[model samples]
Target: MCGIVGLFIKNPELESELGRHVSAMLLEMSERGPDSAGAAVYRNEVDSGRIKLTLFSSQAQPDWSAFDRQLRDFDAQSTVKPHLNHAVVETSKSLQQMQTWLQSHAEVRINSSGKKIEIYKEKGSPASFIDSFKVADYTGTHALGHTRMATESAVTTEHSHPFSTGDDLCLVHNGSLSNHNRLRENLRSRGISFQTDNDSEVAAGYLNWRLQEGDGLDDALHHAVEDLDGFYTFAIGTREGFAVLRDPIGCKPAIIAETDDWAAMSSEYRAIAQLPGAAKAKIWEPEPAKIYSWQRQ
Candidate 1:
């Protein structure tokens, strides 16, 4: 089992400790997945779009010092440090150029040019890595987090959740898909690259394929449910907001909470109940095969 949580605050300028809120939820579910934990925070700045690059490996040790040396020259704000078996870099650049620059770095995956989208994830307990690096120090109104306990694959930074298919698009999932191997083969045959052996990557590839064919986020997600087999709960995030959906069978758990200022969701009611102002809040599980769309307004 895995734990997934996400929230979108209405006011970007508001002084809500979103990082703290999300980390708390993630930690609350620590026992669910002690193997790894991660959180992505979204920020909106004047006009300088931000980018996120995740560098991970089990065979090669990432040289963050060298990487920092490479991007220090860019005329943009950036943050870099060690993350379990990887390094996360947040910068400002066009997606094409960033992808081109990272083509040679097999250990790196770049998500470029969106609102402040900084992904902080690692292969360990939530407290272990989340504290080593003050990821919460970077503020954002909307964010997503995941605590992963690998059921069918090796544990590595590459297999962490909140996998981004594009600059602002990320997907966090719970539940095992019985047809992942077949789906993985299908995706590879279609020329999609996969870094991890986890089934969630298949979900990411499905979304990427849909977007490549010009489908919007909502349609892409709707299509994914029909195209994918097995039980799953996916919290898909975009630049504006996020969408949550479950397979028709409702094999996995998920809960949603809405307030005048925020919308938070998690794989369980306990995580949602942990949110501020949620002590007496009403929370409900979205029906199976139904989609719940929450905007950042």
Candidate 2:
């Protein structure tokens, strides 16, 4: 089991408080999942000509300057902002080009990449992850947070949730998939590579593949409902907005709440209760197999 939380600030004036709100929401779900935690944040700082990638180094003390230099050769305008073991990189290179360039450099692991996305995660309790990452200090439009219990995989940081496979796209799952092995093979044959054995990564890859094939967010999720065999609830994050989905059976828990200032979804309503004005927010459990989304116009 796991816990997932998402908050999208509807009022731009409250964007600066997004991280604080999400941190509170995450802390509320700490009991549901105590193994690890992660968050994907979207900001408007990135321009269309460039992409932001979150790179993680396994080294005790990564040479961020040298890492920046390596990227400089690929995209001279590249900039790396280091935070502990992970660094957020902004580069002018095309997605495919930067991806190919990173292929030869296996020392660095790419988390999430998008024009407006940065992902941070680690193996620890929610409170620990938040404190070490300075999660509460971040300001963004929207964010997705996950606390993983790790029933199926090793409790390493690499096995954390909020996995990403495409630019500005990420997913956090609260349930399991039965056909991931077969699906993973099929997706690999179709050229979608994966870095882990986690079933959730395959789900993220499946959605990314559909999006790459021209499917919109809703369509991609609907396709996921049909093509993927799973009992799961997913919160997906993108540059445009965020989306929530549940399998037809609805075996897992999920609640969505929206107020004038923000919209949020979590494994339980208690998480949503942490938001401001949540007392008057429209609150309800997500229906089975339904796609619920909120985007900034």
Candidate 1 deviant stretches above 4 angstroms: 11-15, 44-62, 71-93, 111-113
Worst 10 residues of 1 by lDDT: 109-118
Residues 120-160, candidate 2: write the lDDT tens digits.
99998999999999999889899999999887678877889
RMSD of each: 3.0, 1.2
lDDT of each: 0.76, 0.91
> Could you tell me the lDDT of residue 185 within candidate 2?
98
lDDT of 2: 0.91
Show where candidate 2 strays beyond 4 Å: none
In candidate 2, clashing pairs total: 0
Question: Per-prediction TM-score, please?
Answer: 0.87, 0.97
* Candidate 1 lDDT by residue in tens digits, 210-240: 8887998878888988889988999988777
Global CA lDDT computed for model 1 = 0.76
